[model samples]
Target: MKTSAADTPPRKRVIVLIAAGLSVLLLAGIGVYGLIQGPRTGPPPDNSEADGPAATAAPEDGTQTPGRIVPVERSSDPETFARNVATAVFAWDTGAGFMPLDYTAVVMEVADPTGTEQAGLANDLAAYLPVREAWVDLRQYATTQHLEITDAFVPEAWATAQAQAQPGQITEGTTAITIEGVRYRAGVWNEKPVASEHEVAFTVFVICEPAYDTCHLLRLSELDNPLR
Candidate 1:
C-alpha cells in the first residue's frame, strides 16, 4: 500500500498530542486527590535537622515525641523564663500542623501571663503570623531553630529595687530585665532546592512586678549577625 505525504500524520505531532493528553490527566488527578485528602500537615523528611540532637535528650529508651511545640515550663527566675520562651518560639514546625495563631498564643502566655502589658510583643506577633503562614504555603515550613542563653542580668534600677527590699516587703515593678543569647535558624525547601542558615546574638527585655507575681515581655531587640 502506497501512502501519500498528506495521508500520514507527522510523528512529531502525534507524540506532542499524546504528551499533552497525559499532562492534562496528571494535573486532573492531582486536583482530585488534593480535594479528597485535604491539607497535609506532615512534617519534613527525617533527614532534616529536626531528627538531629535536640537541646534536651530523648528518653533512655530512644523514644521521643516529635511535632507540636514541646511544653515550656514557667519559672519565677527571669533568666529561666526567657530561655524557655526563646526555645519554644524558635522551635516551631508547620509540617506538624502547628497553626501560627496558636503558636503565637502560647508565646503570649509565657511572655505576658497577666495579659495587661507587652504591647510590643503583641505587635510583633501580629506581624509574624501572616508571614509564617505564607511561608508554609510556599512549602518552606521545614526549619530548625536553636537558642542558647549566655547571660541574663537585671538592669541598674531593678537591681537597686532588690537591694532596698525589706523582708516580706512588696516592691514596685522592676524597670527591666535583659537576656542575652545566641540563636541559630536553619531552613530547607526541598521543592525549591533551597537551604538557609544563620546564627545571631539576640537580646530580650521583660518587665516584672514581683508583688503581683507578674512579668511581661517589653522588647526583643538587638540582633547582631555573628557572621559579619
Candidate 2:
C-alpha cells in the first residue's frame, strides 16, 4: 500500500513542509511578510561602440569562457542592498562562460545567513534566469542582458503587511522594496547586433541592521508582479 503524506518519515516531512512554505511565499506576497511566509529580441552589431552591458562573444573552441562574475556588493542600507540585488538578478551573459546557477550564486552569497531562506531564495532566482536549456540556446546567439533601474522604493503594501502582522510574526529589520527598471537584451543575429527592451518590476525582501551588519536577501516577488 502507498504511504500517505501524513505517514511519511520525519525527515521527508520536513522537506515537504519547507517546499510548501516556499510555494506559499512565492505565490502570495502577503505570506512573505505576514509570516515570513514566505526576455528578448533586436538590434544589429555596433562594433564601434561597447558590446552591451556584460556582453561577451562565445569562444571559438566551443569551450565556455568563464567571464567575469561580479558578486552583488553588500550594503548596510536596505534600499541600496535591494537595488544591488535587483541589478544582479537581471544581469547575465550567456556567452560569459557561466550558467544561470553561477549568476544565482552571486546573489545567493548575500542570502540569509541562517540558511532558512536560501532554498526559497533559490527558487525565486530560478524564475529570473534562463534555464540551462534556454541558456544554451541563447549562448548560440551570444546574447547578454542587464537591467537599467528606474526606481527602487519601499512599497506601500509593505507597510500594510507590517501593520497587520502580529508583533514578531515578521522578522525585525525585514522590509520589501519594489524595483522598477527596463530590461535590455542584446545579441548578434546574422552577424549583426540586435537589441530589445522591456519595462519590468519586482519586489525584493531583505533583512538588515540588527539582523546583520549588512542586508541579506530573504525572498523576491514574481517578475513584473511586484507590489504597487
Candidate 3:
C-alpha cells in the first residue's frame, strides 16, 4: 500500500489563507494609527500652590528658561537649515523600497521659508523628521508579512536632525511660553521627504516643547504651516 496524489493535502490552501490574513491585519493597523488620535489635552490651572514668585528672566534671545518648556530660536538661514535637515530626514529608512535603510538625501530645492516660530521651517523639520522616521519603521512591522526591515537610524542622520530641529523648540516642554502676540510655538521631529523631493520639512506649533522636549514634534508641524 502506497500513498497517492489524492492522499496529499493541498499546499496552496494554507498559503492562500496566510496571505489573506496578512492583508487584513495590515489594513487594520494603518486605520488605527491614522484615525485614533489617542488621548486629548484637558483643563488648566493649579498655579496657586505653584510656589514662589516666578522669575521673568528670559534667555535674552527670546526662549523662556527656568521652566519645563523652552522656545527654540537658534536658526539662521532656512535654505542652509534645509540642507542640514536632509541628512537627518533620510537617517532612518521607512522600510519601503521607496525609502530603505540605505537611502540618501538629494536636495532638489527648498520651498516656503517659515521662520523659527509658529509654523515655520524649524517646526516643520521637527514634525516631519523624527515622528515620520519612527512611524515609517513601525508601520512596516504591521504592514503585511510582519517583515522587520533592517530598521536602524544612522548617526549623521540623527545629528543632522538635531541641528535642524533643536533650534525650533526653545522651550522643550510647555504650552504657550509667554511671548509676543504671534501665538508662537515649537517642536522637533525627524521627517522624510514629502513623497517627491525628499527634502526635510518642519511642523510649527503654538507651544514650545510639549513635554520638556519629550514631545519635540511640534517643531515639525510648525515648520509645515504658517508663512515664515
Give candidates' CA RMSD values in order.
27.0, 9.8, 24.5
Worst 10 residues of 1 by lDDT: 30-39
Instruction: Count clashing residue pairs per candidate.
Output: 0, 10, 54
Candidate 1 similarity to native, TM-score = 0.49
lDDT of 1 by residue, 21-134 (tens): 434434433212211222123332222343333212212343334455666666656666666666665555544455666677777765644343345465554433334434
Q: Which of the predicted structures, 1 or 3, would earn the higher lDDT when compared with the native? A: 1
Residues 1-228, model 2: lDDT tens digits: 112334321121112322444544344454333223331111112221223432334446767648679989989999999999999998988777889889988889998766777887887787777767667767877888899999999887677655655444565667788999998888776667778787888888888765566788888876777766
Clashing pairs in 2: 25-38, 42-194, 42-195, 43-193, 43-194, 43-195, 44-193, 45-192, 45-193, 65-97
**CA lDDT for candidate 3:** 0.24
- From the highest lDDT down, the ranking of the candidates is 2, 1, 3
C-alpha displacement of 163 in model 3, angstroms? 26
TM-score of each prediction:
0.49, 0.75, 0.19
Quote the lDDT for 137 in model 3: 34
- Sorting all predicted structures by TM-score, with the top scorer first, yields 2, 1, 3
